[model samples]
Structures are given as structure tokens and as C-alpha cells.
Target: MKLSEIKEILATAEGVNFKLENGISVPAHFHVTEVGIITRDFIDCGGTVRHEKVANLQLWDADDHEHRLKAGKLLHIISLSEKVLGMEDLEIEVEYQAETIGKYDLGFDGENFLLLTKKTACLAMDNCGIPAEKQKVEMVNLASASTCTPGGGCC
Candidate 1:
């Protein structure tokens, strides 16, 4: 999900809820500790330079169990972050602590925002010499007694 889309969704939502891909929900009292734009500029293994930017929302569970982040409040915080940090309509990456800090891709499932698990991918599969998947074929026994022998002209 993009920052603009979340802002639009927040306009109509009453509560801000985040769920993990595993159906586990982030604690209701979780705090969005930081909202900022993250820029990554690096070289891929394929020897190509790449640049990426994402809107990052860092979620933290605090001791204050009574705290709740309302949709409007989150929207306001997003707007402030945008105004102050010059954020763009980039894809949102959420950082939440599970057993450890995990980064997730943001998504919406009509009712709630989902933190989709992120996986590592190779950017240079072609250059890395990784073998392509081989096609499989079933073998049929054509050497049956009814079949012509190889010495026959039918070979």
C-alpha cells in the first residue's frame, strides 16, 4: 500500500488496525514510533545501480495498555510526517517487533491493514548462473513384446 492510499482509507476509517500475515494482530496499544522516508541506493549483484524509496512506519508496543491509535490520529501523524520529512507517495514498509524486528510490506484487506511478510529475492538471477527449472516428462516403455524389434526395418 502507498502512503496516499492509506491516507484516503483513513478518511473513512474509525480505527487503525494492523495484522500480521499469520492472522495475528498487532497489539491494540501499539505505537507508531516513527514515520519517515527511507531511501536505499545500492548496487545489485548484477552490477546495476538501483534506488528505492519507501514510507516507513515503525510500530512499537509500549507499557501503556490503554493507548489506542485512531485512524484520524494516524492520518494526522502521517500528514505531519509528510510535511516535515517531505515524504512522497511511496509504498509503505512497516517495522514491527515480533520475536525480533521484522519489516513487512503494507497491504489492505478491505477491513484492516495487513503486514505482509517480506522475502529476499535475487535481482540478478540471469547473471548469477542459477539454473532454470527443467521440464519433466514421463517415459513410456516402447520395448514391449508386441512392438517391432530394433533389428527390424521398423527400428
Candidate 2:
């Protein structure tokens, strides 16, 4: 979700909670270690120049189990980051380390903020010469008895 959207959601939530797309919850004691704007500039395989910017929130499961980030506190931190770093209202990307560090897109259900699983996508599918997936057909459901027999000339 966008930065503005989260701000509104935070206003109503009791605390900051990040729910993973797999139905796992990032514990309330988790610390938002970093909040900064990330700007990535690169050239796609299609020879197109691209730039991306997002507000990043890095969550770390800290040793202090009593720490629970409240919505208001997070909002204040965000504001401070904005003022100090000149950050803008960009989409939020969360970085969390489970088995390893993974970047995710941010979202929220009615009751919980969500960390969506990120996947690699071809930046230029058309230029890569990868064919589109073919439509699936169920062989068992088709009437193919005539074509199966050796004497069925229709084959």
C-alpha cells in the first residue's frame, strides 16, 4: 500500500503488526530498525531505463521482548524520518530476515498489516522470447476413444 494509506490505517490500529502473506505474524515486539527512502536506478533487459523509489521499513526481531511498537509511535518515527531525510509519500517496502533477508511489499488486512512475499519477474518478457503459457486441456475429460485405436483411421 501507499504511504498515505498506511498512515490512515495506523491511525486506527491499536499497534503496529506486520502479517506475512503466509499467515505468519511478525511478533509485536519486532523493531522497525530502519525507515528510509530507497532509490534504484537500472536498465532493464529491454534496454529501458527505470528508476524506483520506496519508503523502506526494516523489521528486526529484537532481544527485548517487551518492546511493542504502537501505531502512534511509528507514525511519529515516520514523520521524523521525513523531516530529517526529506522522504516523500512513496510505497513502503519491508525488509525482514527469516532464514535470510527478504524484501516484501506492504499491505494490510482489516486487522493486521501484511508483508507480501516478493517474487522475481522478468523485466522484459516480450524481449526475452519466452512464449506465453498454453491453455490447459484435460485429456481424461475429452472424448478420444476413436483416436486411441490402431484401426481408427481418423487418428
Candidate 3:
């Protein structure tokens, strides 16, 4: 999901709810502590230079359970961020701490916003020295001494 997408969603929703991939929900008392743009620049193992940019939202579970973030209020916050920070319509990356500080790709599953797990992959599979995984082979196809074919077998 992108900033523009969430803005559009917030425009229509009655409340803002975030659901994890495990079916747990971010508490209604959660606060969106931070919203900003993140830019990453790095070199891949394949020697390719790359850059990525995303709008980041950091959700912090707070002690206050009285305030539930309504759709309108969330939209208002986003609007303020846009006006003050000049954020663009970049994809959203959410930071939430469970057992660890996990970063996730943001998405929506119709009724609620979903936190999709992100993974790091080798971008240069072909350039890497790692061998490809071997395919499973039938054991019966092996020429064992016990099963040597015909008279040609010295066994």
C-alpha cells in the first residue's frame, strides 16, 4: 500500500484498524508515533546499485486505551504530514515492535490494514557462487551390486 492509497482508504473508513498476518490486531490504543519517508541506498551482491523509497509509519502501542483512532482523525494526521513534510505517494512500510522491531510491507485486506512480512533475498542469484538445490532422484535407478543388470554384473 502507498500513502495515497491509505489516504483514500482513510477517507471512507469509519475507524482505523491494523491487523497482523497472525490474526492479532493492533490495540485500539495504539498510536501512530511517526510518519515520514525512508530512503535506502545500497549495493546488491550482484554488484548492482539500488535505491528504494517508502513512506514509513511507526505504530506504538501506548498505555492509553481511551482514544481509538477514527478514520477521520487518522486522515487528518496524514494530511498534516503531507502539508508539513511534503511526503509523496510512496509505498508504506510499517514498523512495529513485538518480540523485536519488525518492519513490514503495508497492505489492506478489505476490512482492515494488514502487515505483510518482508524478506531479504539475494538479488544476484546467477552471479552468486551458491549451488542450486539438487532435485530428488529415485534410489532404484542406481546400479547397485546386488541388482547388477544381467550377466554383465561381476557381483
| All candidates: TM-score | 0.86, 0.84, 0.82
- Listed per candidate, the RMSD to the true structure in angstroms reads 3.3, 2.9, 4.0
Which residue pairs show backbone clashes in model 1? none
User: What tens digits encode model 2's per-residue C-alpha lDDT throughout 1-155?
Assistant: 88889889888888777888888999879998999999999988888899999999999998899998899999888889989999888999999998999999998888888899888888988887888889998677335655466666656
Which structure is stronger by lDDT: 1 or 2? 1
Winning candidate number (TM-score): 1
The stretch of ten residues in a row with the least summed lDDT in candidate 2 is 141-150
Best by lDDT: 1
Clash count, predicted structure 1:
0
Backbone clash count for every predicted candidate, in the order shown: 0, 0, 0
Compared with the true structure, what per-residue lDDT tens digits does model 1 show for residues 1-155? Answer: 89999999999997889999989998999999999999999988989899999999999999989999999999999999999998889999999998899999999999989999999988988888888779999776676755677777776
RMSD of 2: 2.9
